[model samples]
Target: MTIHHHPSNETLATYAAGTLDLGRRLVVASHLDRCDACRKAVRGFEQVAGTMLEDLPPTTMSADALARTLARIDGLGADESRRASFREDFEPGLPACLRRYELGRWRWIGPGVEMRSIVVPGANDVRVFLLKGAPGTRLPQHSHSGTELTLILDGAYAHEGGRFGAGDFEEADESVEHRPIVSDDEACICLVALEGRLKLSGFMGALLNPFVRL
Candidate 1:
């Protein structure tokens, strides 16, 4: 289908600079693989940045200047051939960068909330989950502690923010509290990457709190 929503200019710049985290960079790479528009956009930004650097006043540099500049330039070199590499590395059903992830056994955590983790290679404690809105359900009013990236795998959901259907991705700032309601007749499935512990509220929260350790 289509590439997910184009990353913001800031993200593209970060990708070009090689400063974003690996997980976030992988997501951006995923988009760059399918969207040539974004590819050109990133290239344009890099080119503009390079041009600006050349226009800057010349300054005497220490011995490390060459090495540092080379390191910076290395990340900006997304040659035409890189598209194929990115596509191959992130094929459907399996991400080459995350091939070592062995999904932990999935089980129900609540009436609609269920989770299974795919461990990040070398970082076993760190994992991601595939969650679904069982039947006609949704998430409770909750806020994630860290950056929460939700990619819709199936169906749709509506929240105060708006409606998001299959294939849509929403990045939630930790400050936003949401109660996403399943809009489709079926279910909404999502991939979520979480770091800090999830703080639960409302009823059954205490009951659920003691039930799982993820």
Candidate 2:
């Protein structure tokens, strides 16, 4: 699939520096898995970061630091292998970045739309979820309070900006408002990370806002 949208350079830099929150990092990683261009961009940023770190003054390490670090790496590898096996047994078709997290049950949010919340580890304010909308589903018009990141996993959707198909990454801020409609040819499945609450528009949006918990 062709990826027409990508995270901004600033976003990629932050991601490479490991400064992004978990939810946003996962969204960017999902995009990187499908977009080779973004993957290369991230690698470039990582190289720059490594160069900067090399110039920093050296710090002394504990006598057993090397042993402890190696043990930690081994532990992490084992844990990651178990998680991958678990994901393969359950949600086998998800993006690799999402496979590490536990997925909640799919819940119907509208006539043709369903949502499944991802259980992120640790305390986080960002909300991450997968939304599946059948063909012809039109979401309510809304604007974000902070930032919202969306990565299309399957099918396509269109809004004021343009049509987003598989591997498209979209970033929305508080200034943008839109109503996305799933393409009639197939259902649309997307992973989303929202930093703040949605400000639904119109009277119908107000009525449904309470029920449309993201």
Candidate 3:
């Protein structure tokens, strides 16, 4: 799969530093699973962080800190085992990063467009979902109130930015306003993370916005 779009440098840096919110982090992780270039960039950022830490002045830790850390490390083994088992039973055709999420039933949002909410624990205001567009379908024209990250999982779509095929990651904000149309023969499926509510454009979109809840 050829990926023409990717998360911004700032986004990738925040992700590597563990500073991105859970919803956005999940979106970036899903993209990284398929984009080797972004994976390398994340590793580079991690290495830089490690080197910076090594250069910092030493600080004494609490007596129980080491014990607590060791205990947490031990617990991770069991947690990883459970995660491995879960991944083994994960649904086919979905990104590996989505294995841990609970997918809600798909609901029709517009003509040839369907969306399924992704149940993300502790995600209060943020929304995550799987959006599928049938071939030749044009998605609603809208802009976001905050950052939006979209990771293509199957097929392809095109917007003002460019054509996004499987494995492409598109990052948009309030400044962006474009309608995406699926271009592949098959349906286009993408994992989307929205930091804030969408601001629909046009009369039809505004009329249906309240009911759609995207």
User: For model 2, how does the per-residue alpha-carbon lDDT over 53-115 read when each residue is reduced to its tens digit?
Assistant: 689998898999889755542332334445664464345457765666788998998778898
A best-first ranking of the candidates according to their TM-score comes to: 3, 2, 1
lDDT string for model 1 (102-155, tens) is: 566667888787776655453333346667687567665666676666666567
In candidate 2, how many Å is residue 98 off?
2.0
Whole-model lDDT per candidate: 0.62, 0.82, 0.82
The list of candidate 2 runs beyond 4 A from truth reads 61-83
Worst 10 residues of 1 by lDDT: 80-89
Q: Residue 35 lDDT in model 1?
A: 62
Regions of model 1 farther than 4 Å from truth: 1-6, 31-40, 52-100, 122-126
Candidate 3 to truth, TM: 0.88
Better of 1 and 3 by TM-score: 3
